[model samples]
Every structure is written in C-alpha cells, then in structure tokens.
Target: MATMEWIAACREELYALREELHRCPELSHQEYRTSALIEKQLRAWGIPVLDFHLETGVVAKISGGHSGKLLVLREDIDALPIQENTGLPFSSQVSGVCHACGHDIHTTALLGAARLLSEHRDQLHGDVLLVFQCAEESFDGAASMLAHGIFSAQTPNAVVGFHCAPQLQVGKVEISAGIREASCDSLTLTVVGKGGHGAHPDECIDPVVMSAGLLMQLQTLVSRRNKATDPVVLTFGEIHGGSAPNVIPDQVLLRGTLRTFDNRVRMAHLAALEDLCTGFCRALGGTCTVTVEKSLPPLINSPDICQQLLTSAQTVLGEDCLGSESAPSMGSDDFSCMLEACGNHGAQYLVGTGLENDPATRMGLHVAENIFPSQAIEPAAATLVQFALDYLN
Candidate 1:
C-alpha cells in the first residue's frame, strides 16, 4: 500500500484511540489502564504484543516479509499530576491527571504509525519494534526497564522517538545533531542546628539563617563555578524549616534542581554544591547532608540518524517544516535511557511536531490540562509513517 493510503486507512481509528487515551490519563508507573488500552488496540490490529518488565509499559513487534535491519520506535505512556484546564471536549477525565506534555499525542501517533505498518506489512523490511514506556515523569522508568532486561531480547539498528513542542508550529519538525537536552539532577539538603528561644539568638544555631546562606550560595554554582558559555540552571524550588517564628528551628530542608548540558560541568557543579554546603554548615556550627540524585542524561542525537530524520521530515513535510538551530530544553526525558541501552547498535532519537499555531495558546508542560488540535495529530502520524518507510526502503 502507498504511504498516504495506509495512513488514511488508520486515521479515524487513531483519533478514537487518542481521545480515549486522553480521557483516561494515568501518571507515571501507574499506567495500568493505559497499558491495557494500548495492548487491546494493538491486539485487535493483529500486531504481536509483549508485556513490559514494568507492568505499566508495553512492547509490540511487526515483521516485514523481506530481511533487512530492525528499527525501534518508542513513545512514553504516562501523564502528569496536574488538573486539566484546557476545557476541550475530550479533556482529561481524571481530575488531577493530564497528558499535557503531549505524551498522549505521542502514543497516539505511534499507534497510528503501527496501524499503517501493520496494514502494509508486505512493504516493510526486517522488523519494527513499538516501545510504549512508562514513568517518564520520574527519571526511573527507563532505568528500571533497562535493569529489568527489556532490550536484552532484541537490539534495533536505530531507535527513534519525538516530543511535542508547544513553541513550534503544530506540524513542523525540529532536529539537532547533538546535545538536544540538558542533564538533570535532583538535590536535597538538610541543615541541622540547635533549637532555642527566638529571643536568645546565641543559644540556637539558627537553621533558618543557615538555609538562607546555603540557597544564596547554591545560586552561585552557575555564575561563579560553571562555565558561562555552557547552559546551566540551579533553581531552589522548596525550603522548609521552623515550625514557628518565635522558635529557632533545629533543622531546615532545601530542595532544588541542577540542570546542565555538559557532563564535565555537571559533575563539577555537583561536587561544588556538596563542598559549599558542607563548609557553610561546619563554619556555622551546624550539620548538613547533601544528597544528589542523577536523573536523565543529556539527549544527544547521532549525526547520521539526525541526518536521516532531517531528510525524511523534509521529504514528508517539505523544507518549510524543518527547524534549524532550535535551543536545547532543560527538561529531561526517560527516552534517553533507551538511547543509552542501544549504544553501539546504531540507534538514533529525534523529537518532532511544533506547538499550536497561535501565539496566545497557553499550554502547560507535561501535566497541564490543555487539548492540542486533532489536526496536528494526522501530520505527525504521516511524518512517522514516511520516516519508517524511508528507513526500511
């Protein structure tokens, strides 16, 4: 079947699947219902399905008649913990959960592509693996899947995935050769001191004061320590300590995020953070504990795979749909784990699809409740279809 004919055959079914998935959104690691829905759809279409090591994710495989290379396509199957606010007809039915980050769209697009491929199985080469992963919101899902041996069975020659862009036009595609996203690390610091009466400042170590100093110093990690040329963000999002204003608290807690694109800079910044917090607390006659947890690594696209994606996107959507030199986003994705697992297997990952056309369209990241137009869905599916065919041919 021709690419357009295959896409047309599955367009309506894809829309229905997308809306259904959108209405019943599930958060990371809790995608039981979503998994069942996806499994059922793929089974009905006669694609062979496999349960993920993590119960919340699914993997399906389709084989072409001819012998060629294996290609893997992945989509995250999770939502965020945000209340829906888009007020669309098919807005999230789960009140405190939403597919605001367009994972719903991504999954739908993959499924649409799956249907198209299943319909044209005779034209396909080798095999195509459809990976629906869970827990992208937390950095752990992809890591967990890897640890549990998801990719040990079959490694693809190339892996591909895309994220929805709220800033770009709906159907447009963006490609970057390397360092497409920043490395993310979560940090929490506990400051300990002695509690005493507020009036007796000398009696207490004053954790609140210590916390303030630590926060100020943390900000300097980027300006003073990190290279100014590299992108770095140190943001303290939460701080908690004293119970009452009159009582000097014995302990204060600080939580924040560290983001950087360069690995060397990321490691150095983390080390400096620990050293600064330890020194400040010791000098202030208090105790401190700094725990840094590494999240996703920087998303680096392979040059050859990036070139293939660029060519395929231009062929499908023309040169106007291609994006140039877009800035790297600080947000991280668990899909980076898949890329890591496929190391030396010649895998490549790229993000596609721009945000809605209107400048006033206010869509929140990941968990915000907003409905992207259904029109954007078709072109994204079509793009993937063309890209997959190009890879196979």
Candidate 2:
C-alpha cells in the first residue's frame, strides 16, 4: 500500500485501539497499562522499543531504509482527572478520570502512523522516533522523560506531535510557524508573617493583609508592565491561610498559574514577579516566597517544518479544508519541553475531531462530555505518515 492507503486499510484496527485506550483512560504519571499496551502493539509489528528508564509511556524507534535526518513523532498517552459523562458504550471504565482531551485519538493516530511507517520504510531516509510520553496533563511529562534520558541516546533532527481541536470540524487541522503554545509556570506563593490575635494591629505582621495586597499587585505585572498586545494570564485557583476567624495565621499559601506566549517575556515576568513579591512583603515587615514549578516552554513551530506539514495536510484534507490563519493560543503543551531537546526543530498541530451537528462531540477538551467521532482517526494518521515521508525523503 502507498503512504496514505496504509492507514485506510488499517482503520478498523485503529478504531479498536483508540476505543480500547478511551475505555481504560489512565491519568498522568500513572499510565502503566497504557504503556504496556503501547509496548505490546509496537513490538508486535517488529519495531524496536528502546530501553529507556521511564516509569510510564513507551519510546520506540523505526529505522528507515537508509541513513539521514531523524524525525520524532510524539503522542501524549494520559487522561484528565474529570469523570466520564459522555454516555458512550466505551465510556471510561475508570471513575473520576477520562480521556476528555482526545489522547485516545492522539495515541491511536500515532500508532496508525507507526503501522504505515513500518510498511513504508523504503520511502523514508531517516529513523522515526516514537515518543508515547506520559504526564502531559500535569505539564511535567516531557521534562521528566528528558531527565530520564529518553533522547540522550537518539536525538531527532525534528519532532512533531498533535492535539485534538474541538472548535474545528473533523478532517481539518491547524498549524502555524511561531509561538503556537504558551509557557506555563505553576506557582505557590507563601506569605510568612507573625501570628497573633486578629485584634492585634501593631504586633502581628498579618499575612492575610499581605496576601491580599500581593494578589492585587500581581495583576499589575500583566496590565501595567507587559505589552498590551502580548497576552498574559495570572490566575489563583486556591488560597489557604487561617483555621480560626479570630486568629492571624503565620503563613498564607497562594497557588496560581502563569501563562505567557513568549519565552523572553515569560522569563522577564518571572523575575519581576519574585522581586515584586519580596520587596512588597519586606516593605510591610513580612517575607514572601514564590516557588515556581515550571511546566512548559513556549511551543515554536519551525517554519520549514510547518511548510512541509502544510503540504502533508493538503494531500489529506485538500486546500479548502485548511483552517484560516489565526493567532497562537496561550495554552501550553508539555511537548514544548521536548522541542528544546530536539534543537527546537519541531511543530505540534491541532487535529480537529469535532462534528458540526453533534454538540457533545464538539465540547472543549477536559470537559466531561467531550468526545471525538471515530471518523477522525484514519485521515489524521495518514497526514502524520505523509509528513514523515515528505520531510525525510
């Protein structure tokens, strides 16, 4: 079979595999069964599963017919923490967790590409690296896999990954050349101060008072400092301080998330935030600590690579089906972290799985009712395989 025909022939098995993944969705960093299934599937096809020191996910390699540049195709194999309410027969068997982000499709599509690539190795000039990475929802999978040396032995010349886009209809995909995804920094700010009676005005440093002021000023980093055109989001989802209403707590914990589109702006804002927090707290006779758990870097698509994928997508979906040009999103994918490992020569695309008439299928990712139509699998898989052939050949 030709490059695209391979996926069409294997659609039935691809559907079954995706459903199998959807039914037993696994959470980030806990994808033992998912990883095992991937390992079994890849090994069954004579592909070599690399001996990496990863706790979850599988990394396999497909050697081309000859020596050339390496290409890495990654797929996230983890689910979200949401409960399944899609009402499908293959609804998530695991309660309180589901593959609402369409990772089932992502994993299965990549698997389909593996099957096609395995058959069409003669068309490729270089090896293809398959990264079924884990812990994407936690935003630490790519970084953790790097720490474990997933790419230490075999670094690719370019990388590619895909995510489901609920807004676009099935058979369509979106790709851009620059800043496709944002940088995320999960932050925990601890406001430390003297504990005393709430009634005490002078003796108690009052962390509650300090936290309130800090939260208000944190907004200024985006509004007062950064360029208005470049978007930034700083949101706090949790705040815990005192147990008693009459007592002033010694410490207040503020947990928030920061998102930026540019890495240069991201770094500057991070430093500015720490300085602002420290100075603001000390000026009020208190100390504040900002513990930033960095998640993902800005996802930048290589211009040359995007041009190649555009041709690949055109072959599968036609030119009219290509999405209209749009600006990049503030969303972050852990795949961005792996881009740095590959010398920043990669791009991740948004594969549209939404149906125009089916509201449930069109629901945004991470929502309990979000589900993808099975029709999305074959074409998505074919596009990826074609991109590999186009770039490497």
Give the number of the best model, judged by lDDT.
Answer: 2
lDDT tens per residue, model 1, 130-188 = 88888888777778777767777877787887877665666677777777778888889
- For candidate 1, give the lDDT of residue 234: 90
Worst 10 residues of 1 by lDDT: 344-353
TM-score of each: 0.91, 0.97
Per-residue lDDT tens digits for candidate 2, residues 211-325, read 9999999999999999998889989999999999989989999999899988788898999999999999999999999999966888889998888899898887788657765
Candidate 2, residue 369: how far the Cα is off, in Å: 0.9
Model 1 stretches with alpha carbons more than 4 Å out: 344-369
Pairs in steric clash, model 2: none
